[model samples]
Target: MFKHAIAAVLLASANVAAPAVAQPAPAPSTAQAPLQLWRLDCGEFVIKQYGAFFSDTFQYPRGPKNIVGSCYLIRHGDRYMLWDTGLTDALVGNTFDNAAQTLRLRQSLVDQLRQIGVRPEQIELIGISHWHFDHTGQAGRFPQARLLMGRDDVELLRGTPSPDQDSTDALAHWLNGPGQIQQVSGDHDVFGDGRVVMLTTPGHTPAHYALLVRLASGPVLLTGDLYHFTEQVANRGVPPFNHNRADTLASMDRFDRIARNLGARVIIQHEPADIAKLPAFPQAAQ
Candidate 1:
């Protein structure tokens, strides 16, 4: 049902054409960036209750219950960093809306960021795990931030068009206009020193990526859609829907080993239980 809804929504959205003209270019800034990272829930951004559903190979387990989508805010010095923007405000209330409904993103990602005291302008960088609409919804909102993404994902977004033309808008804003986009070929150290590192974890998408944050508790690996929940990690189960099965399995194995070796906590983006364990913003508890 969720998959069907998503397909319908994508089909409906695909009718709209992307802008023909390019946006202006981003200006280089020497502003001192801040280094405080905060994780914001941004409310439930998806609706698919993929708790029990299993993928074809059963390498991973579906969550016990439905999972809620999430967005993260990283503060570096004075500048704000956004990881995986949630669904757009326009689609927040529509029940029949596929991406909006499945992701359960009732609140605007921009609004949630502001609620935590960071405005869009303060954002210096925006990193995406993949080009999925749910993860890239608010990319256009941060025109000033340097958009960081895997090269393959960028290509995929550029190649596709949707109802809102979100991918086109993001690319146009990042590529054509003043938006500074840094297309990394592979993994990148967000702040250098391993405080926050972006790893290329393909499989969910050809260019899917994961984030590693060295929090006070320990290192936290943000597995964006790689595995919907901890059960997926424990049981080695994949979601019914994904771009590639083999790649997803490989990425999961990599995550498990890396976390074990580093004694890091793996935070699955869609798992409510895992998210509950983390300390909310303003109060950082491991």
Candidate 2:
């Protein structure tokens, strides 16, 4: 009986040792690929004054101001990616003009791309910060480009009704077309590394996102309406017109932390001052 008990104890010991012996080693963390950031001027896209609420203020210093629109050109190896599409010709009607003085409205996105020698067909990916009509107006131009959008934004785009009712028919058609659409639920590593990451920051919209680009100049955070201007970031102000005030504040806090941690430069999409600071595309010539 004693011998049998000893045998059983040995068998249990062997079983424990087997697992330790078979345990696999941990995989190494992936190294981030090198990346370059290019600031593409999509001519001048206009934004109606008070079109976007900045903090508690609905109107700008100058009543009903129109602002220039700028998009990004991100180059990853052989492929080129567009951060957002600018205004479409459809937006040039009297209604848009009457809303605010034309601060700056230039050529269409297609025309701008042509001027830069980049065809719409050459664009591999179009990553939208949100589903706003102004930002997404020219998305349909690149029918073959893969559309990357936040998952929550996708639901909001796919006929999910919101009281805002700011949806554009052209945007809806573009999202539902034959082109491939990739939905990201949370923070995404675009290059399977930390180089170009898409962080989910919901506030202005349920699916608002920010892009973090690890550039040679250092890290750069492309804030898409999270804070319309630097003053919003400075004051930690939440815009009056947001889906959720609390969520918006929290998102701002996150942006602060990220910018500090990465020592990144935060670029506000609509802020004219922020746009003026950055070096334009074709960096060598500039």
Candidate 3:
């Protein structure tokens, strides 16, 4: 019953494709040659609650905060890793709208992957940013791949979610299934070369984490929920619904420190402006 209400608020809360970044045509791709990163358009959403309600977590919540749901696909050598699964394709029928803004599904993630010649079986790993419903919508689709998640969040899957269409319920099968799961505690180097690493950034959830993808172009950081919008970066605002306020604040400081040290370009998962920094789908960021 505790998480059931969260499901309701989430469903109630929450489009636009950021314009593509200008860049030269991508280099030719090979299975073992180039590292490829593709950003998929999972879905889009806008907050509908009044200003006072949103102000609890946001600094300037004057209007409906429109944001996009993003997922990523990375190809390293012959191995493939999926960042976040995005919203469930099955639920694409329901359109969300408010007087201020509206969000509709432009495409499905499975379809997006298919466009890039990636089959579900070709996915070697599925790394979830957190345990949110939107992020885990398509996780169960890849049964052959291993699931990587925070140890703290992995432990949360032991119980049942309120029948209110919770994400915990959507991801429960994979969480409890026969597939292998890597429960990470702190920082993790995915390829052990520092090219691809998982940075531990909490606050949105107990075990929420982020990803760092290095390419020939530069290093890119996928901020899970550390800062949903670019404004949150400067404001350093904590949502009212976060798991731990102090944990969130600490993670923010660390998140910025590492990026500054490496000069990484931070990409907020929900911010459309940040999405514009990446090459559009079908164009790998390598």
| Candidate whose lDDT is highest | 3
What's the residue-level lDDT of 43 in candidate 3? 78
The all-Cα superposition gives candidate 2 an RMSD in Å to the true structure of 10.1
Cα lDDT of all candidates, in order?
A: 0.69, 0.67, 0.76
Best by TM-score: 3
Model 2 C-alpha lDDT per residue in residues 77-189, reported as the tens digit of each score:
66778887765555543234444334333556676667667888898988888877667767777888888888877777776464324444545544566678888777877
TM-score per candidate:
0.76, 0.78, 0.82
Select the stronger candidate by lDDT from 1 and 2: 1
Residue pairs with backbone overlap in model 3: none
**Model 1 lDDT tens row, 5-109:** 112122224665753444443322223342454666544634333442445555533443455667788765565678888666566665433532444446677
Model 3, residue 203: displacement in angstroms?
Answer: 1.6
Estimate the overall C-alpha local distance difference test score of candidate 1.
Answer: 0.69
Please, what are the lDDT tens digits per residue for candidate 3 over residues 1-286? 0000112112222243454444543332233346878888877887664344333554674656678888999888889999988877775777755564465677777778889888989999988988877788888788888888988877776555532256766676666667788888887777655567788887778788899887777788999888878767887787676788888889999989888987888888888999878998888798
Q: Which stretches of candidate 2 lie over 4 Å from their true place?
A: 1-34, 42-53, 57-66, 90-95, 100-104, 160-168, 284-286
- Number of clashes in every candidate structure? 36, 0, 0
